[model samples]
Target: MKVMVIVRATKSSEAGEMPSEQLLTEMGNFNEELSKAGIFLAAEGLHPSSNGARIRFSGKDRTVTDGPFTETKELIAGFWLWKVSSMQEAIDWVTRCPNPMTEDSDIEIRQVFEFDDFGEALTPELREQEERVQTEVAERNNNAQGIPASKDEDEIRSLAKAWSGSLESKDVDAMLTGYSEDILLYDVKPPYRLKGLEAYRANWEACLPYFPAKMKSEHRDFTVTVDGDVAFAHGLHHVVPIDEESPVGQTWLRITIGYQRTEGEWRVMHEHVSVPFDPMTEKVSYITDEVIAETI
Candidate 1:
């Protein structure tokens, strides 16, 4: 259960009747205690309503209502969000809150309705949109704060990093560990779907000599989503041949790899490699601005 505690202090309470300095200090200390106890989700205080305003729109006719209106008792000056096991738990915590005004003041604690509370009224699409919004908000917050990636993300990244290391070491067996036995590797060249583990291994072995000097590969736009025993990773694989300047090596190729969780590890179950397609001709080949201009 989650609850929002709204604190309102009347103008008379703060008109030379502000909460004592001792009480103010205690409020700050109490907030700190709440944070340390891991019960505080968020908390913020707002200046008097004089600094705020409300707008009303009726049939495109706008009306502005400035604050410091005579209804201080109904105004909100501060709020604290708390998540607990039940509404009673939230009420119990709110009961311990210190007086926020010199004269007695009212602090309203209301239980916030959870998504599950909607029951049959909650649509799947609405839940998904809500989740997406929350995910975006969290990502934006992390970007703004420069926080490190989440643990699950870092774990998947570590798998890719280890796979890269194995490729650098030319450890075919270790590299193959990232693929499932039912893997289907598709490339632009012939034998597109390198079906099954044995076939994939054989094809890789045959192609090893062609890439004798080893290959340097990097992934971009990488993302992995895992659910239960299944997981997938799809990204552009940028590869460069170390020795031969052949077709794939000479030109850049983008590859998409799909993975599945075998047991507890991530394994590549499918791969699609290709380059840019000719938009006008619908052909899989490199196209540039010069080519497009010439065609036009």
Candidate 2:
């Protein structure tokens, strides 16, 4: 079970007062303990409502009110996410926590709503989208030394195939259309990193002559892992050369791609390719493992 612990400080508590240095140190130590226990998923402390605002709607009219309002009893100052085996376990942990505010303060612990708890009212698509967003957010937070999020594998795989197909077809115009105006690309080959539509097109044009020449290259073992709006894949290029003696020899190559969702559609953001070496001649080879892995 996952639960949210909201810490609310009364206006009187925060009035002309700040968190003491010793209290700050204690809070840091408490957070470290939570991390070590592996039960802490996320946490944050917010600024006082005195610096916030509220928006309200009455019929057709909307109103915005500045903070420092009189309702101190209803304001929240911070929150923490905890994952435990049961509600009682969470309660036990909370019972052990030191008071977050001076004098007497109240902390509210509420269980997070799980998808299954919604009964049959939640559509699969909506759930999937929610999961994707959560996963992406979690990945980013984890990368930034924060709590983790979830990821979806199927959607990412489908998106990868679509992207690769666009490339193999040389649908340059359509493919480039997917990218943002300020897009950035990273690849293992020439033009190391490219930015903008013009530069990307130039790089593609320079490399067009190296395609399969007969059968188009296919993206194989295309497994995509998506977190929120970002996704990535481990894929392979399967192609037979038109000329036998070409320097870029071999019928297969390894590729990894990273993508970001733009304007509600997935687009390639970064790509990496590696041509392994042949032990016999110490030369680069393209007979990648993805084909073999797929077969297995």
Candidate 3:
């Protein structure tokens, strides 16, 4: 859960009073603790209300009011966005925070609403739009901070497609970029599983030459799901030899990929590719009209 801890303004805060050096040091130490615990997302103090203004709306009419108005308790002076297990955890952290003002102050903790909270009201289309908006906001923030923007689901999907395309083109470097240094791959071939990027790349090097010089590959029924820094995608891939004389072609290899965001880049952390086999004969089954119908 995420919560915003708001520091309410006091008379001194509204008057533009700044915290003492000792208080600032104490607050900094507390912030360090929060960061170490991975609970802190963002925190900032606002300028005094004297430098702000508010607009009031009544139907179509609007009225503007200057700040440093009488209600000090109602004004916010600072806030911290935190991720915690529960409201109780938020409260416990808040209790340990240093006083943000020279005088006694009050801090309010409010839970942030998540997409799931909207339930059925958020249609698939709306959900996509929301994700786009979120990506835009994150990119803007990254630009302001001079950090590279992280890849979203669409970008990751493109990367996955490029990886598949590399197999046909035999572009080892491009294919290598799709995976992380610690990637784990479960391929259809022998050895059961391959660990690390070196092993995975070696496997590709040994197999690419066996494929046709002119090859065609397509990803079908692809689906990608992203949640925060982790994501996973699944699809069926069909590979065919472009040459009419070549008999080496396969259809519908089940593929699943897992990705993780590392330093603003999405890299494949895990991959699993397999073909169904008969239990009795231990023979791999290729896709066919009858097989598709049965599966459907």
Candidate 4:
């Protein structure tokens, strides 16, 4: 079972007080133990709420609120992601952890949801997407210490092609695998832009189902340019669906991807996808082969 061990914030933590060196050393030793036991997957401490903000939603309206939120006892100061054989095992591990704060602090352990936990909500396709995402995450972690020294345009283009293929498969995880952790995306949809792989993945999850089961994403006029560890590509991509009844039976979209060689792999750092719009009609012009040829 996977669990998240949450360290609840105390008055001192909310006041932006740092942990003492002795406590830090004790915690570091505990972390090392967790690592040796293979129970630790990830762990991190959070900055105080004073530096954070929250977006509250009601209907279609969103309200942004800055923080330095009250209720320090309810806030989380840090957390650890761990995998163990059972909940009891997780409990045992948490009990062994050092007190993370100078004041009275509490730790809450909750099980993390697995793909199988979703049951019927996760179709075979969705399950496959999840698996692909997991594989990509594993690969990224494995390559963390092996960053390549040279640029390879061909390899970069191949990586781009794989990402495009994932779009056709509606494999959100596979598509996201090509992007960096801090990927910036200017999408055709609302919200103007998206930052981070998690946001991009969520965007795909919400959009992919609208596409047909068997779709084909064809790339044309593809161009790739490389400069040292950085590369960029631009292309016209068309989405064709197997079912004629689908709302987007056939549509064209423009795509520009920025890649940076990181950890021996080409990962997308930025992506901008858009459709041209006519100012006169205030409507998008969905380009087709004829339109593309004429524009060229």
Candidate 1 error regions (>4 Å): 12-21, 57-61, 149-296
TM-score for candidate 2, please give it.
0.48
With a 3 Å backbone cut-off (N, CA, C), the pairs that clash in candidate 2 are 135-150, 136-227, 136-228, 138-149
Candidate 4: misplaced stretches above 4 Å?
147-296
Candidate 3 lDDT over 1-296, as tens digits, reads: 78999999998888887888999999998897676444677999999888888999999999999876788889899999987656766887798898888888999999999889999999989999999999899889989999767458667866865666676678887889868999999998888999998998899899887878876555656777889999998877766676455655655778899999999889999999988888999798887546766986
Best by lDDT: 3
Largest TM-score belongs to which candidate?
A: 3
Q: Model 4, poorest ten-residue lDDT window?
A: 145-154
For TM-score, candidate 2 versus 4, the one ahead is: 4
- The C-alpha TM-scores of every prediction are 0.47, 0.48, 0.51, 0.49
lDDT of 1 by residue, 119-209 (tens): 9778999999987887788788888999743645545656675566566556778777767788888876787577888887787667666
**Candidate 1 residue-wise lDDT at 195:** 87
Ranked by TM-score, the better of candidates 1 and 3 is 3
Error of 3 at 131 (Å): 1.6
C-alpha displacement of 128 in model 1, angstroms? 1.2
Whole-model Cα lDDT of every candidate shown, in order: 0.68, 0.68, 0.82, 0.80
